[model samples]
Target: MKRTVFIIWLLACVCTVRMDNFTYSYKDAMRCKEHICRHGYSYETFYRVDANEMRSINVDPHSVFEMHIAIQAASNGHIVLSEIPNPGVSDPVYEIVVGGGGNKFTELRRNLRRNAKSSVTTPQILSPIELRGFYIKISEDGLVEFGREGQALPLISFNDVDPLSVKYFSFAAWNGVEAKFLYDCPIPGDTSIEDIPNSHPEEPKLTPTDKLKRTLLMGRLPSVPPNPVMEVKLGFKLTSFRYNTLDSKLTTTAAVVVSWEDDSMAWNPDKFNGTTNIKLRQGQIWKPSFYVLNSDGYGAMDSTNPDTISLASSGEATLHFQTQTQNYCFDTTTTYSRWPHDVYQCLIVIEPWEAHENIKIEILDETDAKFEMFSDIDTVIHNEWQIMTEQVTLDSAMWNEIIDLINSEEVLNTHLSDKMIITVDLAKNPDLYNLVFYVPMLVVLYVTVLFGLMTAVMANVLLISNFGEALGKSSAMKQVLTCGVVRAVFCLPSMKKAANGDYSVQEDEDSSYIVDSREGVEEMERSDKEIKYGDKAELAVVVDKILFVVYLIVFVGMLAAHY
Candidate 1:
């Protein structure tokens, strides 16, 4: 049983090997032929071990088996071997023409020989059996070449086999030997020869390739264009002046009213809102008006030349005018001394000769020229007016010359021509004159007298020699006198005491006495209480004793002189 099993396993192995070595169809075999032919136009073939069959036998898709087979060719129609063939022994010889039946054959054969000789160890050529099917052609010239039908060049192998290892049997035939030759005759499964050309032709045309490269070499970009320009025009005028005098030191009040317009026809109001357009127009006119106001005073009135007005691109119009006036009242008064006083009430009228849009008037007086006055309605409307009349008092004796001059025919005649009117009446309160003019003067005089009396009393008190004595007698008197002296000397020089006691002569010197006496008294008191005695006392006593002895000596000398 063991032997039978072993035999069965060996037979199975053999069957697998034979099956793997099964010949591939000529069409299928052409795949390998095409692969090797891609290396060059021509090559050599040898029968040794087949690498193609080995792939099937191993059932290993990645199997790499090669056989070492040598091939050599010469530029001349001869062959050379690296190692000498068995001496005197006949070696198989063959001749091959690559690319036979085509013009490329000669060139192919030459290139194959050149490349084979240049290689380090000639590469092995796979046999035609391993390649499936190949064509062998014999020419009348005795040249033999291998190829596939319709191929431009022959397919040749470079060595006997893979030149590295072998996996199956392969074959090569001598030129004159009897060997089976295979042709790639069309079979049912074979693809049409025309299809082959359609599948792959000569290297693709490079024009389109070059064109694409050029397009990529350069690049893409963008574009630009042109635009427009703008133009503008401007106009100006003054608007209005706002006077702010409450926080300022201005003594007058006035208003400057101005209006303006933009006359530029090109100005598009639609571009601006209604309010904005109005504001812009006003601004154009008023700006110039404001500039004028800044250059002149608020009340300045002047005419601008019509031609000076400018028109802007926007259509608008403006005009400005000004007038100023002031109003105030003042009082006037006068006095008289006698009867027969003639007082005159005169009506004075002033008016503008030309019609004015506005007018103002001002009057000033220094006398109590009492008179009735009111605007004459009609006269004012006509620009004519008068100073109304009222009775005024005058003392004929005191104002005799004035009354005479007023009564003169020349004056009366001049007034009548000028339409001046005058009237008079008896003085009502003659004392009013004195009260108005003299009362304040009398009050001032009385105050002066009272001040003088008080000053005299103060002076008398300050000058009294017994002031200090009086002060010593009564505290009240002392304070009064001291206060009086202080007031006279320092507070009120008007109340200064007159020259009386020694104090008067020494007043200038006595000024320093108060300071000096106070200092001296303090020093004397300090000295009297602060004396010290001890060892210092004994020293003082010794000094005194020495002084006493000196004094005694002096006294004796004086006595001697007396004797």
Candidate 2:
């Protein structure tokens, strides 16, 4: 009877235990107002509850209390939610009872429209415990089930609907404990819109005036005017020019040949003239061509194409020549004489001068010899006076003799007159100029030979005087002979004894015996006495002989060199 009473008490305790679970009724809580329309439950049905309420629901201590939702697409359609699987959960357990005494579900449905545009009905209780501990699991087949019963339902379906249509839904869970949910989607491609065309236009082109202004403002200007024309004369007789060493004095005769032009297209007047009232003012200009003759008699004309030459007064004129004294050499024979063997040439120059008339030149001499004439040659007037040349021959034998005389060691007493003189005549002309002359190569050769010979003679005299003094010294001569004898007798015992040690000779009583055994005693003593006296006498003879032999050898070598 006690066991039966215990069984009855256990049954009463089990029945008295609070089955706090609740049911959600779909038919009673939710009503479909329109056919073929999308519908969903309020997303806020889930909420958080405090520890007391969680304990009341049999939740484990220290475990995160969370709300879970399960959603499945119904036949011919799919159910969409504002949150998916699990959503944000916080402390303080709140209830999600559908059709309970609170309006929390209705308020949640109103907030659902904020995230999505679709209309939603109040959630229904599908089972006896509609608000039980929510637990949801998703399988690889995209099927959702709730609780342990494993009620499988598709999260997406396309029965009697377009297959490309996508059904997107979400759910949230609220518990009295902290929990979290994450939402993710594929990153979208960039498609930012840009403004339309017609916002910009092209710029205008620049003008010539603008370019000019730019250049001027930048401090740049146009190029300068071209160079002006210069006038000169050509063709002149250059004479009376001589080089006495490097010094020069000369005179030149140029005949005035005027062929001038100005901007007016008229020939230059006889002289510089001020402009007439009707004539345009222009500068004076002249250009003259003068011919020069080469040794072969061929002539070429050169002109100052743009230069002016004018006379101070249009009358006869003459140019005077002067210069400082200088060292020089001249040969009239090589310049004026036409000897084929005379290969020397001379240069004469005429310097620039103002225009003159009637140029008269005179050649002066001790004998009063004079050659005066006018330069009638037409090819004479150009720019400044310049160098010209003439060639002549000399008597080769006479030239060689003079060179030898200058080169001799003996003093020479010759005057300038003893040399040669060349005279020139230049008649006065309207145009006269300056002149110059250059020394001929023959003269240079003469001077070079004289200098070389003087050097050689001085060297020979010095050597001979030194040699004579050396021969005169007696002691020096004695040393030479003694050295010769010593060389000849080097290996003899007498020489060895005399060089190394002293020796003495002795006479004994046996028939006046003579002891001569000391190596070179006799020879050394004899040489010592004889050398002193013989040195003076023999030195002259030796020196004379040596000199004779040296001279002979030198003579032979010189002959060979010449051959």
Off by over 4 Å in 1: 1-257, 260-307, 316-322, 325-465, 474-563
lDDT of 2 by residue, 403-456 (tens): 577786643323111111122322222223211111333354467556555654
Candidate 1: lDDT over CA atoms? 0.29
Backbone clash numbers for all candidates listed: 35, 58
RMSD score of candidate 2 (Å): 44.7
lDDT of 1 by residue, 245-279 (tens): 22211111112222223232234434333222222
Q: After superposition, how far is residue 214 of candidate 2 from its true place, in Å?
A: 44
lDDT of 1 at 266: 31
- Alpha-carbon lDDT, every model: 0.29, 0.29
